[model samples]
Target: MYILHRTNARPPLDIKDAEKSDTVHFINSRSKRQRINEKFDAAKSRIERHQKRWTEIGKELPPQINRRHISVISIGGVIGTGLYIGTATALIHAGPVGTLIGYMITGTIVWSVVISIGEIVAFLPNVGGPVGLAGLYVDPALGFALGWNAWYNWTIILPTELSAAAILFNGFFPNKHEDFIRQSNIVAITTMIFFAIVINCFGSRAYGEAEFFFSCFKILTIIALIIAGIAIDLGGGKEGFIGIKNWKTPGPFVEFRASGALGNFLGVWSSMNQAVFAFFGTEVPGVAAGEVQNPARNIPRAINRVWIRITLFYVLAVFVAGLLVPSNNPDLRGSASAGSPAS
Candidate 1:
């Protein structure tokens, strides 16, 4: 029997009729493919244009750093009050050898982390610094977390540094009224902050100049301290200098518990934590990677030097301090209620 299909777009097709309509379906599929191709081509062209524009803009921007400034800034960034004032306590806690080992371990770890960061900064140096680096190499979330945390840390640190400077000043002027000291410190810190902002805002050269002077001061102070300490130890000021007997006498390693090696390990770990805190600012140079000149060259140089610099300033400082004043001495620990050990 023959079956007839009536039209209204041929009604519903039976199996045989559907097979005959495959040509129509093929035409529709080809048309959809053509539309997709057009959309992809347009998108590709748009992206290429955007990329070219940005490349041109990047080339036009002025270089933000020079070698001299970057070198000095890196040094200044790492050398701060922590090395000067905080080393004594770590010495007392860890003893000379333990303190040295603790700083070396932490410093090495910190330098390793910084070197990984440096690899990225060398490729894309910009004012945004590590925040920008994080966003590029990692993710937006990580970048945001690091950026804000770093900013907050610096904000807190500025005031703390100012407070320390004030206390140091008061040491030289013992009879000054508290109110006067406070006001004077406020002025001095405010002036320093203002100058720093101004210099940074002007250009890298100005910032570099400021950093050079800052580093020079720190270097001079350290040298003088080392020289004087040696002189005092050698009996320079009339009382014949006492040698390294303090380390051997009070003992280089102190036993916190009357137990086993595990107890000693825990004790040393606790002492290491304090030493790590004192050496924490060594990462400042890593943060300055973006502002560093010839980052591929200078940055790696700076990162390579961090371990030695930290070891010398922090570990050596503790060693010298221990030599001058034995760790076990009650006076070195001071009283919990009292101010810092240096005071």
Candidate 2:
């Protein structure tokens, strides 16, 4: 029993020795850690104070979209009346070859723009997208300017889209009186606005779902149109194996005002506006990075798909349209009442 007691006994410690013990050291370290944490929190708060109010509020809403949603948004956000109707104007101005060349040039530009936007969005994932990117990395004043500029653009675009839809809706009744067309346009605009409000009110998830559905539909429709145009060219219609007849007859390029290569070059240049218009919304995927899951992975994937969308949707469609119609067609001139040049 005496041996056991001796073995269990601990050595005595002096004041200095006790201060260096594990328990005391742990206590001191814990207090130091607390101070460090407090300083860190203070610095974080100070930094956050400089952030935009929207950036703070944006974080409160968790990401609600996935890779597929982002891809669809990027792919379809800009596929609209511009491609369907505006291409006609391009064809009228620049003939088949000129229009095709203009679109190809614009496609390259669009690809570069989307790539740049995707890189920035993946790195930063800002709420204001390009606007926020400018503020954080470039200059806050630049961001502010871009924000208001974007606001002005969207404000103009919203009403213009509604007006375009109204005009297209009026196209169904070509023989209708002017008053009837005007009234129909009013009704179409109101109905579209109501649907837009309802869809947006359902939140991002609903918007994503709706966009996906429409994107798929548009994809199928464009594909069908292209196939039909090809078939008609290859003797699938009464025209019977049109081949490159239109191209040969009208020649490859049209002059804008002059009668030679200069006119053709000018025609191609003028068509650039419509080509650029066709790609207006291609950057939406970057804009949507804040609302998408795993933006680092998904945004780049979506950006990679931009070229595919441009080639299949815009380039091929333009090529097929050029094949199907002569640039000098009177219908391609388009009257005030003509809603669609293709139609």
Candidate 2 ranges beyond 4 A from true positions? 1-59, 341-343
lDDT of 2 at 122: 78
Where's the lowest-lDDT run of ten residues in candidate 2?
A: 1-10
Count of backbone clashes for each model? 1, 1
Error at 272, model 1, angstroms? 3.0
- Per-candidate TM-score against the hidden true structure: 0.70, 0.81
Q: How many collisions between residues are there in candidate 2?
A: 1
Tens digit of lDDT per residue, candidate 1, span 1-343?
2344333365436877666653332123346687878766764564456446545654764445566656655555556556665565566656656666666777677767777766655654443566655654455578789889988987887776766565555555545576876777777677767876787688655666777788778867776776787787778856677778777877666555534566455546656786666665665555665555566687766666666566666656666766777767674554221224452
Clashing pairs in 2: 235-241
The superposed Cα distance between candidate 1 and the true structure at residue 306, in angstroms, equals 2.3
lDDT of 2 at 184: 92
Q: For model 2, what is the C-alpha lDDT against the true structure?
A: 0.79
